[model samples]
Target: MSDNDVRQFTVGPDDDGIRLDRWFKRHLPDASFNVVSRWARTGQLRVDGARVQPGDRLAAGQTLRVPPPESAVVAAPKPKAERVPLSPDQIELAQEMVIHRDAQAIVLNKPPGLATQGGTKTHDHVDGLLDALQFDGESRPKLVHRLDKDTSGALLIARTSRAAAFFAKSFSGRTAKKVYWALVVGVPDITDGMVDLPLAKQPGTGGEKMHVDEEEGQPARSRYRVIERAGNRAAWVELQPFTGRTHQLRVHMAAIGHPIVGDGKYGGQAAFLTGGVSRKMHLHARRIQIDHPDGGKIDVTADLPPHFAESIKLMGFDLSLGNAMIEDGPPPVTRADLKAKAKAHAKSVRKERRGERRSRGSRD
Candidate 1:
């Protein structure tokens, strides 16, 4: 603990909505809030390479640079931390990521590069962290929706079985407002537009990609508006997906001749233009608005990741512009039309959940 060791921490889903001082307490338990305040004043702590106050809120995936107390190596691998199936480090990691929590739900500012659900090769993921996320022992939290592994932002978790069912219905009913932010490779000619292209899984991509396949594809629509532009080079865009299709935003943008910055899978090496902008994907789940189970609404926002923020700064983009946020557009359609779709979708989701539960019960 003598030599200076710099440690960088990336904000995670659960860590969203947390104050900088509280963040230090959770992660750097040794650092007192008073010391953190001093550090912030002296510019010792930074989020996304920008100095911030200890009272500032943190979003998922933002880089937090700090020198661990006592010159300790904060990033040093915890000794045998992952020895057990679920280690203390794992549980701590899960506990530290809570952005918002209540009796019925939990909202996380999921950091980029973390998988929401586990896969064959993926082990340590949000899904795997459910054990620690079970703040209440009676009911295990449930995922309301999913975000791409490389995409960071506000993700919801249901705290109870009733809440989980309600959330499922809200999402399937299309009553939720999901917004995303991304940096595209080139500036689009049109500022505001909607892509009504049908999308389907492209063959030979390991079933992990979606393509604009009008012939045999499901309805996928997205409305995008250019927030800020750096001439004809790159621009910051706000995207709203109308249909919940896999890779809908990426494919829709790419199909329109403007691939998202750092999206190598779709845009290739051209995704990056060299220099300071990191090649990491620049897509983020900026915000989501949905009705709460206990009435009212739950609105959450997540800040850009360090890489995305760097890219934005590099492009001289100002997120405080008038067009930075696109709050309300025309309603999808008449209430009657939406009601029919909601009814059908909710019924299907409930049936599916019931089937899964019954199957599990039989197995047990």
Candidate 2:
């Protein structure tokens, strides 16, 4: 292959610190791992003008250069899927999920067992049915954040790419407040408190589980209030997670001796109740508050699902409690902050800037 056939890509913020081989699989799925390593050995895989091994991690804003493929076996890139579409059936299904909608965003009371995004075995998802929420003729409604498949509740969708970017920054900046409602097997000893635990992926679960770990875990925090309890059988709890880690709430609650009801993954058999309660996971993303891309605060709430409603009714728990809007957290990093972060990230990606950081102390 000649130099004229080269292609280049800039590492995206989300892909930062990803292994080069994994990045290739994600962006260039047609390229095999053996082919990537061959390019590395032949000095054709380069990052920032220097040859890089496939094991090397890629950072945000880094320039990666790709040499021409050595084999004709590589398949041509497929045309990108046009903006999402909804069949008449999907439109009918999704129409019932829309609790709120506007020019900039759509709020869905996503049902349990429906995935927010497609996965290996998940072809049916809220992301695929977004055309139902397409306000205008253009069908570009985009998902801003994800709700766990079994956990039903509010899922926000941005109506445009500009709004998508804005909402994405809001979540990354930790300015969005999301409130979850769950029924736990056992009541917490305290009525209200915070669970400060570091979490790491549980081994041998194939990336589908989480557990508390002190040394090699990511920091996670969740504030909770036990709204009501039914004779030590179960409790209705409101949870607010400060850090958005996978399975944080489930693992945290299980670690605290009160696993969420019907959470067989983390809570084991104890999570099940004998008295005919639906075995479905009882967690719900009841409400969310985030800054709107256009203007004002986009605060929305969702109603309970069938199983959750049934459990609440049988337990005689106060259904009206804790549904009010929550106060907004710190405002999302401003546009100026985002720009500064991007600039700093780009500079840090340069090898020369590794040893050139400014002083840590304040000037004052």
- Residue-pair clashes per prediction, in order, are 6, 0
lDDT per residue (tens digit) for residues 1-364 in model 2: 7678998899886566667997888788888888889888988889998999998877779999997655425877778877555678889999889887888788899999999999898999987887677757265588879988999999998876556657777787688889999999888998888888899888898878888989999888888888989988999999988889998999999999999999999999999987879999999999988898668998888999999999999888878776643543333347899999999888878745544443323332
Global lDDT of each candidate:
0.81, 0.84
lDDT of 1 by residue, 1-364 (tens): 2225767889876566567887787678667667788778887778998999988878768999886665433354345544236689988877767778888888888888899998888976898888788876476787879999999888999886557656776787778888999989888889998889999898998888888888999878899998888888888889998779998998899899898888988887778777678878888888888898789888878777788788788878777862335355445567899999999999999999999999999999
Report RMSD for candidate 2: 11.2
Q: Which residue pairs in model 2 clash with each other?
A: none
Model 2 TM-score (2 dp): 0.70
Q: Candidate 2's error at 307, in angstroms? A: 0.7
Model 2 CA deviation exceeding 4 Å by range? 1-75, 79-86, 324-364
Cα error, residue 191 of model 2, in Å, equals 1.2
TM-scores of all candidate predictions against the true structure: 0.66, 0.70
Measured on C-alpha atoms, candidate 2 has an lDDT of 0.84
Clashes of 2: 0
